[model samples]
Structure formats: structure tokens, C-alpha cells
Target: MDDFDMLGAPQGSAGNGIGADEDPAAAFLAQQESEIAGIENDEGFSILDSGEVPSSLIQDPDDANSRKQEVEWKEKAKLELEEWHTRQNEQLEKTKVNNRAAEEAMVSELDENSPGTEWERVARLCDFNPKSSKQAKDVSRMRSVLISLKQAPLVR
Candidate 1:
């Protein structure tokens, strides 16, 4: 009435029930009033409650400093992304060079005419991974294979 006390009363109160002991119609009316009051109180909810502008919206309107900081953050992010891409490209190029040299050396090892390059024979004699770089164990096995192949007499 005078205040929105009854109008804003919570739902399911003395007015919102069809129970034999309670009044369903009063309950529904009270619920509707409460909802209407809530809508009116909510900022910018409807054009019905005059110009009761909300205070929160007026408090921190997007100021110049906020906009400037936002732009600065975006620029910083963009530069960081560019630097990341550049570093990624450099690493990729380095890997390509390393792989190319490794492939060439592997091919040479496979070629029979290439002297002292016996990776293919070593790979065949020992169940070793072809991609394993020139490690001590593989080299040791390769020397043994070379020695055995050289010393073994022709048994045709």
C-alpha cells in the first residue's frame, strides 16, 4: 500500500496457495505483486518505473584509462604472439637443417662404396634403431661387424 511491503512480499506467503487451509487467489496476487515490484526495482528493467536509473551503472562508467589499458593489453598480446611465431619458425628451420644432415649421413652409410660408413651393415647386424644418432654402443657394434666381415675367409 504506502510502501511496497505487501507488494514486495515473497512468493508462497499467506497469499499463494490453493490449500484448503490457505487462499490460492490471494497467494497468486501477492506473488504477482512481488514480481512486479522486483522488476520495477531492477535497474533499466522497464520504462514503467519513471527514470529510476540504477546507481551501479552510474558508478564506474567505462572511463578513458580503462579503455587505454585495454588497448595496451591487446597490443602487448599481439606483439608476444608475433615473437612466439618467430621463435617457432626459427626452431623449425633449425630442425630441418639437422634432419637434412642426418638423412645425408644415413644415406652415405647405406651406400656400399662409401668407405668406413657402415651404418647400414651395423643396422642389419644389430637390431638397432636407424635413427639413433652415432652413439658409442652402435659404433662399437659397427666396428665389430667390420672386423668380422674383413677377417672372414671366402667359403664358396
Candidate 2:
């Protein structure tokens, strides 16, 4: 009358009640064991093994040429780095000198005690009104003088 009773065991046989088809856990374990066995016997598994470089390619312990080349490259790199540093230091010194000269030129153009002769002459040209009249005329005159100086091209 029950579902288990429909599939009867052999007559007079003492069955373990739980059949092989009904046990999913045992079937899974058997499948896993078969897969593990297959993997263990596989020929491609040797490819997973680590390979080392041949001894011939490695630097010879007694060879001087390899050592000499290494030392030469290191010396070359050191010399190039030193030259770069020297050039940077020279550039920095040149910049400092140029900045110092510019500062000196600006200082010489200014008069602490009294206005310079050029300033007084330019001021007189525009009736001493530096902001409006004098500045405009002075700017034009200064531009002309700068142009002429450039045209003449100082022997630097």
C-alpha cells in the first residue's frame, strides 16, 4: 500500500531498507572519488611542475668579461648621473647670477636720496603729473629707446 512496498525486495531476502538509488550522499562521494582518481593519473599533471633555467645561461663564476661589463655599465651610469647633477648646479648658479644682475640693475635705476636725472626730465615733460600725462609720454619714449637699443643689438 505504501510507495516502498510497491518496489518489493527479493522473496525471503533481508534488505537494508535504504537502497543505493535512494542514497544521494553515497552517490556524490563515489563520483568525487572517481574524479580524484582521474586527476591523479592524468599525464598533463607533470606540466604543473616548476621548470628551472639551464646552467649555461647563468653567469659563469670565473668569467671576467661578464663582471667587467657589469662594472663598466655601473661606472657609465654613475658618470652620467654626476654629469647631470653638475649641469643642474651650473644652471642654478647661472640663474642666480642673472637674478643678482637684474636686482642690481633695478637698484641702480632707483635713487634713495633724490629722484634721478632721467626721472626729473621725464617729469618735467608732462608738468610733473606722473600718473596721467607723464607716464603716457614716458612709456612711449621708453619703448622707442628700447626698440633702438634692440635694433643696435648690444654685443652680448
Model 2: worst 10 consecutive residues (lDDT sum): 121-130
| CA deviation > 4 Å runs, candidate 1 | 1-33, 41-61, 113-155
lDDT of 2 by residue, 46-97 (tens): 4334574545545566678888999999999999999999999999999999
Least accurate 10 contiguous residues by lDDT in model 1? 11-20
Listed per candidate, the RMSD to the true structure in angstroms reads 13.2, 17.0
* Full-model lDDT for every candidate: 0.69, 0.65
Error of 1 at 93 (Å): 0.8
Q: Where is model 2 more than 4 Å wrong at Cα? A: 1-67, 112-156
State the lDDT of candidate 1 residue by residue for 84-105, as single tens digits. Answer: 9999999999999999999998
Task: Point to the candidate with the largest lDDT.
Answer: 1
Best by TM-score: 1
TM-score of each: 0.47, 0.34
